[model samples]
Target: MTLYPATLLLHLVGVIGLFIALSLEVAVVSRLRVAKTTTQVHEWLTLSRVIDVLLPVSAVVILISGLVLTFSAWGWGHAWIELSLGLLVLLGLLGPVINGPRMKAIRVAAQAAPEGSISPALRQAIFHPVLRVYVPIPGLVALGAVIMMVLKLDWL
Candidate 1:
């Protein structure tokens, strides 16, 4: 196969991996929000560890493959390309700046609480206002990037 098609396939695979990681994060956080017991909280938090690994790996794959595709086939002049790269950076930052610390706090709270029902502190940590606002941003940004890529939007 040609370099362009091979890189395109890799880029698509990366996107699929990214979506899977993001979906798992959402599901785990949703479960953590409703967890009645510390055990359940711990369980869900353990599951989130998968996201910690998957998100970065997928993102790296996406970035490398996307850059290759851009340089090889698409060039850097398209408005959609620029915006999509910006969105990818934003998605990268959101995980570390917003989601990571908040989830760490929730895990800490879960660890400190007893094995019974969830504590107020744990509940608050799980349902942080920031997290509530931040949860949908990644998915929405990713969706927008996908749309732009598919449409080859050229509103530059």
Candidate 2:
């Protein structure tokens, strides 16, 4: 009935959407890592495009709703809100800076490779060490933000 509850619902929806996108990305990356053929890689890459849409939409929803909530009910001084915002920024940066280019490279390699077993370059692109290390970071950061939000942690 009120703005706060409505905005909170929207924020929760955004969080759910974000996790859905992230989970899909995890699945796609896992599949890509072991994909045996160019067809498999291409299929998974197509699925990843769904994430390209979901992640940004969810993020924008979260940000706008969260800002409304912050200004209305929570104020700007809470440590948890600030930390959560920082985590959101980190997630925003990580996707474009780390995952975007790597996934693009994999897509490019998959497109160029002949229709057959995965090529050496495609394998290398899929299993890049940096991507492997980076995959869990966003999930962990999101989890931390959720924890802070729930607990309203203020130990700053």
Candidate 3:
């Protein structure tokens, strides 16, 4: 197969993986919100860390494949491609700077405390304003990028 088809396939698969990861995050967050036991919190924290690893991997695949696509045929000068690239970069920056450290702190707290009851610190971290604000941005931005790519919507 050609590089274009291969890269497009990779990009599409990456988007699928990222969407699944995002959905998992949402479901886990929902569980965390209603978690009443330490074990529940701990489980969610562990899952959060595990999924964090996978999430970034999918994102990187999407980005690298998109880059490959751009250089091959999409071209950097096209406004739609540029917008999609911009949103992907935004999401790439958003996750590490925002969600990563916050999740780490929660995981640490969960690990330190006994597996009997959920700690206030852990709960607060899960509900932290900064986390709450940034957690959904990447997914939303990814969705926007997908929309722009699919619809070829270029304002410029």
Candidate 4:
């Protein structure tokens, strides 16, 4: 049950897309803290929109294609593969269900807050307490995915 090279290539593309999206999210947030101008704020908002829409889609494609490759390459019931895919799904779901609404609230607040008085309240909401937990989740999951893929732990 070998995978064709083309399918593997597509899966890799999805993975890379997801990675890029996450990187952009980090960059956008970094700029957000010092976003002095309205235009800068708008740019960050637009980036957030792109991330909100595209990141999940790319993640879905990555997970589905990874599953296809896993089944085709190693068959179902492989322990580490199942665990890895489940974790991927969890990571994907967390973005929309937990992070999306929070980010939207932050964005709306940012837009409403007048220039030069982007208050601490607005910044606090945008970089909420939950972010202390949420921001690191993807990185850890991605790291685990890499490790599991490389090790192929078969603990059943």
Task: Tell me, by TM-score, which candidate is best.
Answer: 2
Q: Which residues of candidate 2, in runs, are more than 4 Å off?
A: none
What tens-digit string does per-residue lDDT give for candidate 3 at 86-156?
Answer: 77777777777877788787777777877777778877877777876666666787787787788887665
TM per model? Answer: 0.96, 0.97, 0.90, 0.85
Query: Model 4: residues >4 Å from true position, as ranges?
Result: 1-3, 37-39
Pairs that collide in candidate 4 are none
- Per-residue lDDT tens digits for candidate 2, residues 1-156, read 899989999999999999999989889999899889999999999999999999999999999999999999889888899989988988898689999999999999999899999999999999999888887778778988999899999965
Candidate lDDT (C-alpha), each = 0.88, 0.91, 0.79, 0.75
Ranking of all candidate structures by their lDDT, best first: 2, 1, 3, 4
Q: On residues 25-76, what C-alpha lDDT tens digit does candidate 1 reach at each position?
A: 8898888888889999888888888888888988888899989988988898
- Candidate with top lDDT is 2
CA lDDT, candidate 2, residue 115: 99
Clashes of each: 0, 0, 0, 0
For candidate 1, list the clashing residue pairs, or say none.
none
Q: Which wins on TM-score, candidate 1 or candidate 2?
A: 2
Candidate 3: TM-score? 0.90
Clashing pairs in 3: none
